[model samples]
Target: MAEKLLEVRDLVTAFDTEQGRLRAVDGVTFEVEEGKTLGIVGESGCGKSVTALSIMQLLPRPMGHIDGGSILFKARDLVVASADVMHDVRGDEIGMIFQEPMTALNPVQRIGRQVSEVFLLHKEMDKTEAWASSIDVLEKVGIPSPEIRMSEYPHQLSGGMRQRVMIGMALACKPDLLIADEPTTALDVTVQAQILKLIADLQKEMGMSVILITHDLGVIAETCDEVVVMYAGRVVERAPVLELFGNPLHAYTRGLLQSIPRLDRERKTRLPTIEGNVPSLEEMPEGCRFSTRAPEAHDEAAIRERPPFEEAAPGHWVEACRFCYAG
Candidate 1:
């Protein structure tokens, strides 16, 4: 087997609210190999972002907690690492691009200073060297007027440009792993394509592994080498990207695939939508969480117990319901 860059095992993250302790990331397990791209896909509130945050150990303390599981980077246990140690590991070995570039970037600071911070903090480089490297990285990420743009604050750049800056910062240290959470959200189709292409190209050029979190199956198809499908905080299916697109076993995966708008589909036909909203963490169903939204799961008999993640075919795993199995 290829050397694993990062391995997440039975990760369970939770948030304490007045209502109860809500499990946001429940038992998500996967690995990203060196120089490979892994996509985490799910609708909103499915714990995709939380899973990434948990791996980074960036959860807000008062409300959030890493309740269980192991996050191993290079065989070093990150779950028990100190904040200072985590700080050292974050930008130096593991870089992350958050979902919202506007919110993730500091509005008050110039882009250069923000991007250079990684170099200064992790590489222990002088301010001048860090700044120069910042411009170089920005230029490499295809940002125009790199020198001038570096001096501009976050508000001065377009959505795509800001995203490029975010990617630049994440790649600045040449980290082994890059965790991108919905990197292309809200961008036009053209810009989205550009950003995804940039990531794919960079991953190859830099020899970096990536975990891309998004709801769009199209994005996964375009970029990821492997795919993990999540529902109600659990991994319902996982496989090679081509295997997933070619033959998805889980009903939820099928629903997601059908929801993607395709030019090949008959014109003027409305796209299929998975019925029911993702269940709130506080009100997760008794058995398999996805049973509630599953097209053939309207009856109670369809949801007796949570299905085990079983291999339906070589390298393709999914949680299967007996009723759906028969169908």
Candidate 2:
């Protein structure tokens, strides 16, 4: 068994707005083992990205804060880490690949300078060495003609090449844990496959753990070892990839799996979907957050109180009314 690289316990993160303090991640708990990939799968507004940002302590300051709970990275509490400590940890220990490379990359800066900053700031490398290392990493991430590309700006590169540059920058310092927030989003199918494959190859080569946040079950299936299903800022199910796919116990999980467009299956008049919508944080439903959309949420227990995360089989966990999805 691999060592646990990161452990988040009952994490509650919230954003304070004029309306109220809205909890974006409520009581979410999970762990990532060293050299393994843990996928956080959920739809938009499900707090998947927020959870990653909280771990990095990059929440937008006073507006966003960790209300309660602990984020233990390698057994060190990150929630309370000072600014200097967090500054050191961000790129050197826990690198992040943000969703959009165009926005994430500096438009005015040259690609080589941006990539070299990681080595210059954390690795104690001088200008010449850092610049050399930048080109080397670009090549390592499969960028064509790395030396020539180094002098170009973000707009000069195609979407895929820019993404590769982002990956290169993230991995430049060789962090222990990599958090990729929708890394393959907005890319073409072929490019998506290439980016996913690159990440998998890099993780294996570096022997680092990964926290992959995405809504695409297909991507999760291809790269993840374990998956955490989130709905309304809460974890609804957690299990190994195969078990979750083969024997999905939560109604929400089943809905997600069913909604996948399968080429082998007969086309339906209308695609299956979970009716209604994810509740807003302020007006979240009582009992189970998903009970509003659950087909079998008629029982009193499901409506009266929140359900506990119970282990259904080995590592498979389901948190819903006992009778929900029971049939």
lDDT per residue (tens digit) for residues 200-255 in model 2? 99999999889999989999998999999999998999999999999999889999
| Model 1 score (lDDT) | 0.88
Model 1 poorest ten-residue lDDT run: 318-327
Could you estimate the TM-score for every candidate? 0.96, 0.96
> Candidate 1 regions off by >4 Å?
298-304
Local accuracy of candidate 1 as per-residue lDDT tens digits, 211-325: 9999888889988999999988999889999999998888888889998888877968788898879988777875777776766644565565776778888888887776444
lDDT for 296 (candidate 2): 66
Q: How accurate is candidate 2 locally (lDDT)?
A: 0.90
Off by over 4 Å in 2: 297-301, 323-327
The most accurate candidate by lDDT is 2
